[model samples]
Target: MRIRPVGRHALLLDCDNPGQVEAWRAELWRRRDDGELTAAEIVPAAATVLLDGVPDPATTAARIAGWTPGPTATTAAVRHVEVPVAYDGEDLPAVARHWGVDVPEVVRRLADTTFRVAFCGFAPGFAYLTGLPERWAVPRLPSPRPRVPAGSVALAGPYAGIYPTASPGGWLLVGRTGLTLFDVHADPPATLTPGTRVRLATA
Candidate 1:
């Protein structure tokens, strides 16, 4: 683990392990509940973590690395949500073709693995999931779709994600869902918070 100071008030933690990222994410939730690390926010990315407190990034990084894993990591609060989606995307057939597999096989492989949220990006409540099956992984379209409807489940490279809102996108859409991933009125607006374990339910 390496820590670098972004400025005077934040630290960038680089830990390549997804497991390590998860550990810290869960740990932060614990500290937030128990009052250990006092920060405005803990933003966990695919390969990095950001702490919105403290000035000296080097010192703080050392402390966090030596810190022990907390209890919240083991708690049942971490949720694995099953999101049901329609398997009728325009790109579905293309995905099957790209992977050299049938559409049914594509769905089977996608549902086989439990994905972890690598980062929240592109839009509100959108989570970039890591570790999609290699066979089904493909690149984005040559041209970005003018408006990818919300809840569109897609795969590109080794990642899969759901569109949080209607917007332009290039990720190969495999399906769409009616479930709301974000709601401004709610306390935690994003449905798939970082560290959330997710699985897809085909409609």
Candidate 2:
């Protein structure tokens, strides 16, 4: 793990892997809730967590530097969300070929796996989920679609994602859902915030 100062009041912890980031983020959030750490935001990414709006960067950095990398004892308050999906995407056959399985097997595998939100990027409410085994990793499309419809359940590399809005994307579309992933008028705009667990159910 490497700690780097982002600015006057923020520290970016570069973790070795996504597991480290997830574990550390849980620990940090636990500390903050227990009145141990002070920060305005604990944002997680692919392999890093950004501790933003910190009161004392120097002290926090030093303190974090001494910490060992391992699973934290923190009990995360995880949220589980079920997404109803129609496994009828244009790239469904391609994904099955890549996995060396039939179309139903692909759907069954996705339905069985409980994915977690690793991060949110690309567009508003677009979450990058991780949970699929590394061996089942899929490749991005050779060319991006001119416009990917909203709620398109897609996969790329080891991450599963849902397109929040109509836009150009490169991820392999395996399914689609009617659930609204993002809503500006809602309390929390994005439904799949980082750390939230998601399950894809056949619609």
Candidate 3:
């Protein structure tokens, strides 16, 4: 891991990959909870973790140097959220054709697999989930829709995500969920967060 100063308030931990990033993030959380570290926010991104609002960047950097990642995969102790989806999307048939499977099989595969929220981006409460079988990876739509309705369950590349609010997107829609992923007035706002496990189920 490489530590780099980000301005005066934050330090970025550059990890080898997302898995390492998660491992380091978890370690940081443990340190934060144990009063070994002080920060206003600790965020894990694609390949780095940001320690924001740090009081002493140099001390924190030294502490990180002595820290070792606990595990490569985010621990299963993370909370699991079930999302009910209606497997009826414009791209349902297309996805099935791509996988050489029937629509029901696609739904079954999605429901049976457990996923983890690797990160969040593109929109508020929009989480990029990992653990989809590599063979299930699919390409994004050639032309992004002007507007994709909220609650749309979509897949692009190797990730699955839900549209928290109505907006433009390119991920191919495979289903729809009724859950409120993001609520501005709600405490903590986003329902899906990094390291949170997810299970999809048919409505």
RMSD of each: 2.3, 1.9, 1.7
> In model 3, where is the ten-residue run with the lowest total lDDT?
69-78
Residue pairs with colliding backbones in model 2 are none
- Candidate that would win on lDDT: 2
Alpha carbon deviation, residue 149, candidate 3 (Å): 0.6
Q: For candidate 1, lDDT tens digit of each residue in 73-122?
A: 43276678888878888888999999888998888877776887767877
Question: Candidate 3's C-alpha lDDT?
Answer: 0.89
* Poorly placed runs, candidate 1 (over 4 Å): 55-59, 68-75
lDDT of each residue in 12-86, candidate 2, tens digit only: 999999999988887888878888789999999998999999999999989878766456443354788999999
- A best-first ranking of the candidates according to their lDDT comes to 2, 3, 1
Q: How far off is residue 97 in model 1, in Å?
A: 2.0
lDDT of 2 at 100: 99
- The better candidate by TM-score, 1 or 2, is 2
Task: List, residue by residue over 1-203, the lDDT tens digit for candidate 3.
Answer: 99999999899999898788878888898889889899999988888899999988999899889988776444456788999999898998888999999989988998898998888888889999998878889999999999999999999988999999999999989899999999999977999998888998889
Model 3 per-residue lDDT at 40: 96
Candidate 1 local lDDT, residue 152 = 89
Rate residue 10 of model 2 by lDDT. Answer: 96
